[model samples]
Target: MLRSIKARKGWTARAPDEDFAGAAEEWNKWFDADPSARQGAKMPVRIAGMKVPIAMIAEA
Candidate 1:
């Protein structure tokens, strides 16, 4: 996901004031727009301190 954001044509390092929720929404849009981006991707649930086999980040 970080790689994809960096790979975007005009993405610069996010501003200091930027919030994660806004960025996540934007990235989610990108992820959904391009079907290929989902191939073999396993997104981690970082909001949780401990790793879980299945963590929910967003509503499906």
Candidate 2:
């Protein structure tokens, strides 16, 4: 199935031939540089019938 659309615009580009460690390192570097990105989005999570923001949960 994947081969059928292999020539598609993003199909080939989406799958990069890089190791997991290398990719994770690159992502960590970007995440560290972007301070605002560290602040988790205001998405709510339901716990014990209470809607809590994800950032609050992350802090704990």
lDDT of 1 by residue, 1-60 (tens): 433443323222333234345655665675555422221223333354543232122322
Worst 10 residues of 1 by lDDT: 35-44
Error of 1 at 4 (Å): 13
Each prediction's total of clashing residue pairs, residues at least 3 apart in sequence or on different chains, is: 0, 0
Give the range of the ten consecutive residues with the poorest summed lDDT in model 2: 5-14
Badly placed stretches (over 4 Å) of model 2 are 1-18, 33-60
Model 1: how far residue 35 lies from native, Å: 8.3
Inter-residue clash pairs, candidate 2: none
Clashing pairs for model 1 are none
